[model samples]
Target chain A: MIEKQINQKAWFMVLPVFLLVAFSAIIPLMTVVNYSVQDTFGNNQFFWVGMDWFRELIHSERFHDAFLRQIMFSGIILSIEIPLGIVIALAMPKEGWGVPVCLISMALPLLIPWNVVGTIWQIFGRVDIGLLGHSLAALGIDYNYTQEPIAAWLTIIAMDVWHWTSLVVLLSYAGLCSIPDAYYQAAKIDGASRLSVFRYIQLPKMQRVLLIAVLLRFMDSFMIYTEPFVITGGGPGNSTTFMSIDLVKMAIGQFDLGPAAAMSLIYFLVILLLCWIFYTIMSNVGEESSNGGV
Target chain B: MTFNWMAWTTPTATFFIVIFCMLVGMTIWEIKCPGGAPRQSILHFETTRGDRLFVSLLGSAYIHIIWLALFASLSLWWAFAIACVYALCVFRWV
Candidate 1:
């Protein structure tokens, strides 16, 4: 075995990335923290309010409902996208002219801006001018996402699936590609059924990537804002108001800076906590896999 | 209902023309200097060619201002052409 030297030079290589992340992420986070503890009465006037906003947010029924809605949305999105992505990945041809075309087509939706995606769906779901709306109306279906709560939920969910399922497919495909052919050959020689092969070989191989996919989808879906906000505007009696939407409403609409800041902190913490849990479980599984190999 | 046939046609035509010219130019360059040409320098910090194109075309203030100007002048075809060029640039160069 060759001994590897620890290279300090790579730290310099990573410096630019660190600086960019700090500018984009850390500074804004610090500003949010600053705003959370201060009471503001417009025109930059602020007074220290120390934990008042936090207490109020915790007690607010609106916050509670928003939180529950957020959880449900995230849960539903994960359950749908992950399995769908996996199946799509599995169904995709491994090698041929079709691969690149399929990959590019799948990736196209993800490349569109979040706001544009919302606009596309909004138009697509419109009963008057939109294709989907016109077809549904022609077929005698009472489908108006703008008015109905269930319609709003279904449209948002479908839009999210269309937008994000490709990520899971791509990640799972990468994981599948990395698995050595020897494993498959051995399984085939053993006369393993397709389901058994998937169960025993494909799934274990995909565990790490699936963990990553789960965590990414969880964080992203949990903090989803632009698409749903543009489409639903958190309307239909606030049935679709996720936490981020609620935060924006408080901060910008109501100008309740303190409460919004507090809620933002809570939101950040929840994501962090969930991410940590995911990381722990994933790492432990990785360790177990490596140890089992030994 | 708001579908404009003329709005789509001009830009689509312009886009294909630009792409055709670029590809033809690159092919000519390759034929004339089979052995070598100066390598294009790229900014190391940028993510991808596509991302850079997106920044230049849609994210840039100038491009947006130009687009708005064209739209205001009712040069909708011109606006569409610019949009097509924007898409083509992103697809080809990033």
Candidate 2:
């Protein structure tokens, strides 16, 4: 039986992290909450404006557009990255020196800062000086991300895929590595084809890691700001303006503190809700699969 | 176009110095209470010595420089595209 005692010892171990996260996260959150309910007049003077900003943000067309765009962007990123990661993981060698090489390569993109990823793509897609843009122009395709909305969207999507697909690959690879050799041997003895083996063995084995990849990618993509903001600045007429970008514009650009604060709270809650849903679904699937195996 | 060597030097130097200090601090702390290496399971592979080293050096360098450059440039999208190619090459070959 598990110990029922009040484990004060574990709290000691966790205290440092708890304190750090509270300082970094909770304090700012409280500040945002305070700002959400109060109006500022530039010189430290404030007035109570309960629910006014919240209502304004909720009714704003700009907010609606950005919110929709954010959802779409997150959805596209998840769909593309998750499947691509699984495929890459499958193609990678199960064992040998190639394993380390592949793993390192896959992890390289995730290591780069979000802004760097944006900058690299921005230069790379330039028509005159940039390699990709120059090459495409040479091929007679007029690909200008700065001037064209479709091209800008494509470039942003491609950039995201390039930067984050590695994460999915690494996670999926880990899931693949954990599958026992005995499973493969059993399948082989039964004369299972490659497709069947992958279907019955690899797919099921990878479910948990895939779940993690999905949830993480979804959350990160939803909150993405730096890369796209740097790359497109929310233009070709707000084509690539995700919610985070709009929030930043509101908070810092316009100094609409109350509305920005409310929006941030709403944004945080949206992410929290999505994360909870993802967790519940994943755990349910895990339980069902385990039960089926048993 | 002329390269901004002066512009580059300060940040790069600062980054290295900070990293060096961090390593020194961590080493001292580890000696006091040697903890087991944390195990993180990935789907297709386990973490190896070479993998960890490569990631630590390359990852930190890329993250720092890219983040800095993003704020420095007038046109960030162009820089982002180039970085993607660089990342792709690093992953594919490095």
Candidate 3:
């Protein structure tokens, strides 16, 4: 066997990336970590409280409520978006003049800015002037997102689904497009049913992209802030205050720096742990499925 | 440039410095020994040196946070001990 080469020069090439990450990410992260442990008066004076902020955060009931709401919202989002996206993708035209039309119409929702989506939904759900709320009122429904907690929850969930389901659809469509003609030919020869084709041919082929879509959707939904903030402002009695919104309220609105910083770190860690679990479970399932439990 | 804007405190500075050292040390080890191939372990997935390190660091952070939450005091040594055990298990079996 030939001896493997080790080039020390590679470190020099990596230096620029290291510096970029250090300045962009590490420095800000370290600043937050620094603030998490220390309390402050005015004039940039800080006293080392040594985990006091962290202690307060973990034990706080507000934190628990936000966390549970976040988890529930993410669960609902994943459940709805994944299946709905797959179905939409399946029904999407694969060839002819309809393909671009379908693709562009589907992509239209995703191209809108997040804040604009929130604003649109906010207006569109107004009982007095907005289309959805006005229509619901005309139907004799007692739907008011501003005052009713259930209505507020439903509206935000609907808004998120409308805003983001396109992403899942696009990814799944791409996955579907990448499936070669031979797979369908093989399935046809075997006299496979539609569901069988989807199960053995489509889904297995789409697993990689679907995994990506699931992870992206899970993380984005878990960290949801802007749309809900713009629409509900965490109002109607804090029913929709996810962790990021709560963290912003603490850090910016209340100016509780230490607790806010601590909360941020904890919040990030929870997401990390959850994403890791999702990644592990999904990967294991995919591996087992593909390898026939080997 | 002064780091005064960072609101630097001694303990937090030391904490960051230690983490920096760990990263550098891991890189050096990878360069010298070069045993960084992905391997399957008890965790039922393939992991490399970097993956184990990431899990270890993340686990240690949660350990410390949990200790603070439960005891209402920073049990540095105990948390460290737990983190070491956790890291060892990850390194060996994950």
Stretches of candidate 3 off by over 4 Å are A1-16
Candidate 1, position B32, lDDT: 72
- The docking category that best describes candidate 2 is incorrect
lDDT for A284 (candidate 2): 65
lDDT of 2: 0.77
RMSD after CA superposition, every candidate: 20.3, 17.7, 2.0
| Model 2 RMSD in angstroms | 17.7
Best-first order by DockQ: 3, 2, 1
Instruction: State the C-alpha lDDT per candidate.
Output: 0.79, 0.77, 0.90
Question: What are the per-residue Cα lDDT tens digits for candidate 1 across A1-294?
Answer: 999895669989999998999889965776676677677787766677655676677667998899999999999999999999999999998999989998999899889999999999999999999999889999999999999999999999999999999999999999999999999999999999999989888988898999999999999999999999999999788999999999999999999988898889778777766785677667667667666862
Q: Each prediction's DockQ?
A: 0.01, 0.01, 0.77
| Top candidate when judged by lDDT against the true structure | 3
TM-score of chain B of 2: 0.39
Q: Which pairs of residues clash in candidate 1, taking residues 3 or more apart in a chain or in different chains? A: B49-B94, B50-B94, B53-B94
* lDDT per residue as tens, model 1, B35-91: 333222232222333334334443332343345433443544565567667666544
Candidate 3 lDDT, B36-72, residue by residue in tens: 8689978678889898999999999998887877776
User: What is the per-residue lDDT of model 2 for residues A207-238, given as tens digits with 9 covering 90 to 100?
Assistant: 89888889989999999999988889999899
How many clashes in each structure? Answer: 3, 29, 0
